[model samples]
Target chain A: MTETEQRAGTRPIRVLIGKPGLDGHDRGAKIVARALRDAGMEVIYTGLHQTPEEIVEAALQEDVDVVGLSILSGAHLTLVPAVIDLLQAQNMGDVVVVVGGIIPEEDAEELKKLGVKAVFGPGTETDEIVRFTRASVGRA
Target chain B: MSLGQEILRGDRRALARALTLVESDPHAADDIIAEVYPHTGHGIVVGVTGAPGVGKSTLVDRLAGQFLARGRKVGILAVDPSSPFTGGALLGDRVRMEGRGSDVFMRSLATRGHLGGLARATPRAIQLLQAFGKDLILLETVGAGQSEVDIMGFADTTIVVVVPGLGDDVQAFKAGILEIGDIFVVNKSDRPGADQTMRELRQMLHLGPQRTWLPPVLSAQAQQEIGVAEIADAILRHSEVRLTDPEQRQRRMQEAERLVRDALADQLVRGVVSRSQADGRWNEVLAEVAERRLDPAGAARALHLEQD
Candidate 1:
């Protein structure tokens, strides 16, 4: 494993990178997934146009330490909260939720209020996201 | 309720948690599994294995749908390889599978440095699924090449998937997959060389020793959902035959023997290694071996397994 992918006891940190809602653009999500994998994390990339229910179900099934939602379709206000609520309703509030893709400062703040751990807008370096992911999850 | 109780009550989240525990904390997992062991042995595990790009995942997805339609609760465990260098893995098998509704639980596993085309925790995960009361469990192994036959020990029905145009009839024999498969699927059979591939596979099967149930070489275009039902039927027939067939009983005995041996081996090594480390003998012996003052076998002998 890479130096960054330290295990809490055993098994690498598992992350679910999901694209919720009608966001067709997935380049950012793919790049972040690749960066996480290179850092020795197991990344489960749920391909594009996933519903919030689908994303949360995947999180529950995967038991991922983190859920990174990428939304470029300006539906973060709707899709992000839906995912957060489903996770929380399932007693998965400890699963760190992060938002990426085209989210504005104000909306990002609003999402953080809704329990998103962090937000990365466009042009945020994948390394920054990777470091933040490593820091946010208990496994790391 | 206890974790095992929750799992037996049909809680999906608890099943997920127990599966994670299987990978991260074996001691705790052992306790939970002991509680639920009696609830298991009901799930039929089907192992789908093939070389890379041979449509194993899609075929599994299709077969799961078939079983689900037949009113069976389905679970899927798809394994991909981890990077030997970094230990990281990008698990993409789920992408190939369309959503199979909520009752069909799917999990992606990375073979974290384990060999034989599966993760070390796979059997444990399968047990968790079984305890959660899934009627069918489909195991998709890492794109297996030659000699990754460990699936035979874990699967009730082993389906060896292949595509056309790879090689002649001898290819399957060379890979040693010919012997382990209970049923063979020539997936993506819409391609030009599908007929020749199926013919070659049948020819090879006939050349081998006969059994109570001859492994059927079937055809399928898993992507389009064509011919998948036939393969599913074949799987069901094999599962039925596996119950009373003397040959299958012998195979099951062999599998149980291997599982026992593997568990004993793991426990012995872990016990001795941990004791040696606590007494500082492990590091000393390793250092000696590294410096070539003591050979590797001699170092192992120094551990004195008989006394430990």
Candidate 2:
């Protein structure tokens, strides 16, 4: 078990799970969202087909602890950086940003350089994600 | 140290807790801000925005690691989209950073349905981080659309990331993302067509008259960690230049003034509406408006008159 699991008690981390763009495959996104929720964090799953504006607006109002994006349409190249830029423009540079699904290793590195905290690829265990989140938020 | 004092002294843990309180119960925001306000304005804020799939998150992760290597304490705000189905957020940004969460300085926020591409609690969150003594703060939003551009008003510097084969030029033009980018990054440089995309971007940038700050176009293979250092250097340079610009300071102050006024107006309107509802006056006004006995504007005017 990770240190986070050992330290996990209460104080669930709140995460905002989003699906941006016209991507229609939401099965993975929803499953991950549920997994995060079951892991004890408050998960807000923004339904499929969200515009960038809608996603940002939701992040602001919900006051989420993190922004998790799941995109499978290969739009990560266009969408992920845009989200990061928008947050920075809004003076929200302190929020942890991560992405999951179908991201290539090369693209993942690009995103990290752009200021994303982490990127999860296919077959990553939901528990590992939960543990990472707990550790990131310092709850562990 | 007391929580308030710790926050003022730039304690990361304290800042995180304070932010949690503000989000869960905004009634405490004023108190927390009052305590930490004096310690802010010492950090550089960088905004990274672009359309979906532009590899923004990986860039951020790499940049944070770069800054960490430089011994600078960093704070990141990764904004996620709100769930339309449930009005909540899934908050998954921390997954990328993995073990870095041990740093005790990073946080994430969901949009929670706030408009203009900014998390409503984002400013407060940044202030909390600033108070925590973070030398640099980065905000990564969900996408680079128009609302994202509007939110750029809050940052000291804004970096826009675009990837090759994404038709970024056309999208940037359409979304006005190009206008707001202080620096443009062509991520995924190893991909075919990256050179053409960069060349086209350079030409597009040069098409306009040169401004005081020339936006540089840099290429990065983020997955390979190539050019990450150059990107960080560019951000620092821009921040340094912005700090020295009097006009930039003036613009920030102006923006702050507008935000303050807007917040006050929203609060006042909300207060009056809620109070009227408790006093049964809101229902009466609504009835009148619904029955066409009085226009909604007229009813609102009457409420304002009563307050006066």
Candidate 3:
């Protein structure tokens, strides 16, 4: 029997990894998505160029345990807050939100102040991100 | 308000949570489903299946758009396979879907190592959508193989998509898939050998025993939305026949009976195994079987006898 079949009758954690704005570089996003999937989390990848509204809409509809935003467009301040606001406004304040991609240290702190769960900058280990996500969603 | 009541009242978040509960904690979902069961059977459920890269998701996207244009509230359940090693899944169907809007509800499901090209909770998810007042529910299966025919039990209409150059007419003779399709679509028909593919599908479909509904073999380039309207029309036609056909009631009842029997068998096995394990009899029997003191059949019989 497969590993999953051995644990039949249980559900795995679900995550949505999305890239918002006009950023077309999805290599980082795809890498993280694969890492999460390999770690046993179902990851919904909403490819590039998504608006904040679209990201939150997908998060709500999918009812994911975590929303991992991979933003490299340098628009994290505007887009991240927009997504968080939409999510909270839509009554999804409990969904854990994480950010990845290129972000300065100061902005990362700023995002945490805005309720972003964690910010993953360049050279961050995928395993570290995975572990952090699991703990954030209470699955670790 | 109760979650079931909220779902019935058309609260999107409530419905989403209920669906998550259905997938994650089915035991908890039982009460909710019982509460909403009477309101189900109102929505039309369509199942789309095919081999990998056959454009099942793309076609579903187009079909959802068609239904939306017709003013229908649509719910989509897209199933992908979970990794056998880690149980994780990359459900990327929404990437190809541009038709989802405020009125369209889409959720991705991992098969979670369950076979038959669908997640275990798919039927319950469909029930929830029906209770939420969706006019149509689209179920897109993980790339189906020849024997993944479970979708037949749940969907009102089943569309099997295929692309050319996969195989020839002999491939269609493979029993299970051909038997379950209510409609066959040759997606990516713009590619070479399209006519041959369609002709083979039509011929194979004809070879089946004649029934109330003759499954139509249609061609489509699903990416550009070509022939999608005709596919919608075919689904409508099939639905109409099913609604009016006298035998459909008997078919549905038979399906229900099968589902109940399967569930009962599952519960019986689980209950017996858990009880045996708790009492140490299961491990005792396992050791006996491992040492060759008792054969597997004898151990199984002993377990069953112990249950009494």
Q: Highest lDDT among the candidates is held by which one?
A: 3
Q: Can you list the residue pairs that collide in candidate 3?
A: none
Residue B130 in model 2: shift from native, Å?
A: 0.1
Candidate maximizing DockQ: 3
Taking the tens digit of each residue's C-alpha lDDT, what string does model 2 give over B1-308?
66778777655446657877765545456777878778877777878887777777778878888888888878888887765444445555544542353342556676655666677777778877888788788888887455577557667778888888875556555436777888889998888888988888888888766788889999997767899999889988988888788787788788789768867986787677767767788879888999999998999998767766
Model 3 Cα shift for residue A117 (angstroms):
1.7
- Choose 1 or 2, whichever is better by TM-score: 1
Query: lDDT (CA) for every model shown?
Result: 0.86, 0.75, 0.88
Model 3, C-alpha of B191: deviation from truth (Å): 1.1
lDDT of 1: 0.86
Interface root-mean-square deviation, candidate 2? 12.3
Instruction: For candidate 1, give the lDDT of residue B37.
Output: 84
DockQ of 3: 0.65
Better of 1 and 2 by lDDT: 1
Give residue B182's lDDT in candidate 1 (0 to 100). 95
Docking class of 3: medium
Supply candidate 3's per-residue lDDT for B112: 75
lDDT of 3 by residue, A41-65 (tens): 8999998888888888899888998
